[model samples]
Target: MEIRTGELSNPHVIKLLQTHHNDMLKHSPVESVHALDVSKLTHPNITFYSLWIDNNLAGVGALKALNTTHGEIKSMRTSSNYLRQGIAAKLLTHIVEQATLRGYKKLSLETGTAEAFLPAQNLYTQFGFKECEPFGDYEPDPYSLFMSKML
Candidate 1:
């Protein structure tokens, strides 16, 4: 497996992100889904990456610069067929390493609080992320669960 930058135009990458966006909205209320779309993830402040295994797209993740010392993890999603295959963990591990390399003192993310999101929350917790108050432009919402870890 290999992680590569760019390739945003690749068919598999686009489909994976579309599924991620759709799932977020499907599981969470419209107002509570904070997942970014392809355009949002394309910002200059954000870096997107896709994981490939034998040239097949396995997962995708992105990191967004919040400031010089802070960053946010966004759009982490593994293809349906790759579920439980450690794809998400690998993408997350890569994002955290990139955050550290960028000199970020902190890395944070927002996920849904619904039962469907428990696995994701647990994954973040396993990586040392703790519950936190909402940051950035986010406001207080019961459906939104925010977490952060020191890089």
Candidate 2:
């Protein structure tokens, strides 16, 4: 698998992101769903990535620079066809390395608290992300679980 800087215009990447957003909506209320759509992922603060295996899109993820020393993980999703193949972990490791290269002192993310998100929570925990109070512009919400890792 190869992880590279992604283009939001790529149809494969767009479809995966749409699926991720739609899945999030199913698991949480609209107001509680923080997954960024295709257009939003193109923001100047965000750096997106796509993992490809044999020319097929395996997964995607992004890192958003919150400030000089902080970053946020966004749009992390493994394509259904590539689920359980360790694609998410590879993309995550790539993002974490990128954040460290950018000199970020901390990296945080917001995900759902629903059972559907348990695997994601476990992945983050394995990466040393611990539950934390809300950071960035986020507010406390029963449907949202926040986590962070210090670089």
Candidate 3:
């Protein structure tokens, strides 16, 4: 898969993001469903990426600058057809590398506490992320699982 910086104009990537938001709404509480839409992802502080395999969109991920030293993972989603094929892993590695290169000292994310999100939680765990208190504008919700990895 090829991973590259993306803009909101990518229709396929935008659709996947919308699907991710819908999926989160189905399995997570309102507060725990933090997937951003295209407009939000296009903000200056957010860096978005898209993964393509065979010229088809495979996945997408984003990193949002929370502060000079910290960043947050946002809108990470693997296409259903591309799931379990290391697409998310590669995208994650790319995001982490970008965060480190940008001088971020910590990377944090919040995913749902439901089974639907267990795989994502596992992916983060493999990268040394551990449970942490909510950060940024988030509050501690039963459906929210906060994790952070020091870079």
For residues 51-76, write the lDDT of model 1, one tens digit per residue.
99999899999999999999999999
TM-score of candidate 3 against the unseen true structure: 0.97
Clash list (residue pairs), candidate 1? none
**Could you tell me every candidate's TM-score relative to the true structure?**
0.97, 0.98, 0.97
Candidates 2 and 3 compared: the better one by TM-score is 2
lDDT (0-100) at residue 144 of candidate 2? Answer: 96
**Which candidate, 1 or 2, has the higher TM-score?**
2
lDDT agreement with native, every candidate:
0.92, 0.94, 0.92
Model 1, CA-based lDDT: 0.92
User: What TM value does model 2 have?
Assistant: 0.98
Error of 3 at 128 (Å): 0.4
- Candidate 3 has its poorest 10 consecutive residues by lDDT at 1-10
Clashes of each: 0, 0, 0
**Colliding residue pairs in candidate 3:** none
Give Cα distance to truth, residue 21, candidate 1, Å: 1.1
Lowest lDDT block of 10, candidate 1 = 33-42
